[model samples]
Target: MTRVEINFDGIVGPSHNYSGLSLGNIASTTNKGMVAYPRAAALEGVAKMRHNLALGLPQGILLPHPRPNRDWLDALGTRPDDVPETLRPAAFSASAMWAANAATVSPAPDTGDGRCHITVANLRTMPHRSHEWPATLRQLELAFADTRHFAVHPPVPPAFGDEGAANHMRLAAGHDAPGVEIFVYGLRGGAFPARQHVEASRAVARLNRLDPDRTLFVAQSEAAIAAGAFHNDVVAVANGHVLFAHEQAFEDRPAFYAALKRLLPELEIVEVPASVVSLEDAIRSYLFNAQLVTLPDGTMALIVPGEARETPSVWAWLEAMAAGNGPIRRLGVVDVRQSMANGGGPACLRLRVVADPATVDPRFLVDESKLDRIADCIASEWPEQIAPPDLGDPALWARIEQARRALHALLELDALL
Candidate 1:
């Protein structure tokens, strides 16, 4: 079975601060308009995409909660009407929710199919005092309960002097350790320098620790320049292979290229221009979540900047992926305008469990119109159920079955596009 894995940390909003400057960081603001906004709309888009895939194959999904503070409450507004009623309470006090279930191993309820796992950790922003360690450990335990093997690790604390701690830990753990890799960057309450080289070195160290034989290290040119150790640390660690963004080349392509050549003469440097689609901006501010999904045909899909945009910006990352020779046959651009108006994008709203291609009948892609018809039938049979009066009904269930059949027929179609 093909497995789809994702990280679910906090929610992203359109603007950084609704309360005051003291309430959030600059990245929070950027995420609001770009990552968070689009993700809200794209949640359904992702679900639909998954539904489409399920029609033809067997798939599994992995979900991880990066940390707290970026919780739903922080992303969505505090007002009752600001969030869907079902989510309002959870949004208000998600930390309490985490604490209450600290003893439980799985952060999210099991889906019964034994294909999903939710890792929960105490909000990373919280003080890592002795008192907090137990809860943190409990959260980790919950996150890895059902799975035979999983990844675990701490993030580089922003307050720490080093920036690349998280990346370093991830790389050092190597892919062989079935358990979650814990990353410990610095001491508690210490201030870390934000230099890029320091961060890059940490990343290199981690990479060296993890998959030393098969790992490749890539970074944006701008990020490399900012750190000043681009050649010595990043290139040296990966043995000559590096990925650079186009804008980085534009600013000082000659110098950047020269540096790579001198450090690792035979290095295979992949250049991704700024003009090409990318989610660098989104990722910086913790707005969008990007995942690399491989299809049954061996093509890859990069789903990022998950939002609903009138233009094609949401799927811009695909261009970059294509340039890198990623195997992506179809692009699922999520439309999360409604969700964004409130808050979030595809990455924010729904957690991705599985995104690999399925092995069912090739007919699933039959006709877009037929799929639409099936959607309509499903909608009619299962009208949006909200509140007590809108619970599931037998009639609705029957209609859902009929819609499912229609969906199956469409799935059976060979030329769906």
Candidate 2:
């Protein structure tokens, strides 16, 4: 069976807003209290999927999870009407739009049963994102329901914080071949919470039944985390056998590299030094958070945010790297400032799954026509803007619910409803 990597981007929901719910994310905090453009944000995400399709890549979509999560409020012994002001934003959060945090995926070639394994993340570090798993699990079960090709597991217990694929990386000679999987966990990040725990990573590896000898668990640099690299993907990304990272991404670089080399000697590291682009600039511009993907022609391209180009040092380093004789030969820039403002980049917007497209749910897959329909729905239904006060308005909540229902009807995914 032939398998290709599909980039499943989470469609930005109608309730998209910047509540500054994520404590460690600088962008989110900086943009908090500003009016958000939900309609434009969602259309921007749809355009990104279309961009992937034009690149000759398989694209899929994970619908926005239901917002104003009434169930969560009920669980907290409160109703929406009487819910405390502090808890209001959590219920309406659109954080699930960053699919990288939705789940950790192990492709078929690297799993024990020759089946793809997807384990939903228990994002317990932030209260706003903690309740996302249940809704996320529903989507995963539907999308990868085929027993022959996929095994979807519920989130690991919340005692250990797991931020999914954001903190995970897989490297292989080819998508269909056995690969080395690296799980990066963080112990501390000064005032920020270290989101990915080693224990959680270990549990996920065990659940997926990955080969111990081929899997390496490494620690994220405390400095990188403190500098605002909340997830490993923020500082490093792996596609095929290439690892593009910031120089300070890992705690013990030489040791991790040695262990990785022992597992897979063909590894290629495109480490951007701090001398050229400081870690502060790297995190601010989300340079490493860009998606490093292999193009259809076998050459690789880095899909980066427009912010990368705007940052002088980051752009200079990227241009020099691409111009030189290196494994990454091209650069693709995308405008996701709507998501960028909330601390997500092109990489954060997607979850990579290497599998036979035929086995996945057809409804979840996308092409240009499907995107047109999705975008049209957004234009007509999504709120034009949402301010802080709008979050508490029952009218806004009703509109948001109706907008999601309309999208479900359009996609014929009412099963998720």
Cα-lDDT of candidate 1? 0.30
lDDT of 1 by residue, 380-399 (tens): 43223222211123343343
- Candidate 2 residue 16 Cα shift, in angstroms, is 0.7
lDDT of 1 at 107: 13
User: Where in model 1 is the C-alpha error above 4 Å?
Assistant: 1-140, 146-148, 151-271, 275-289, 304-326, 337-417
What is the Å distance of residue 152 in model 1 from its true position?
Answer: 4.0
| Cα-based lDDT at residue 374, candidate 2 | 95
- Backbone clash tally (model 1): 55
Lowest lDDT sum, 10 consecutive residues, model 1, at: 14-23
lDDT of 2 by residue, 109-222 (tens): 999999999999999999999999999999999999999999999999999999999999999998989999999999899999999999999999999989998999999999
CA lDDT of every candidate: 0.30, 0.94
Candidate 2 segments exceeding 4 Å error = none
lDDT of model number 2: 0.94
TM-score of model number 1: 0.39
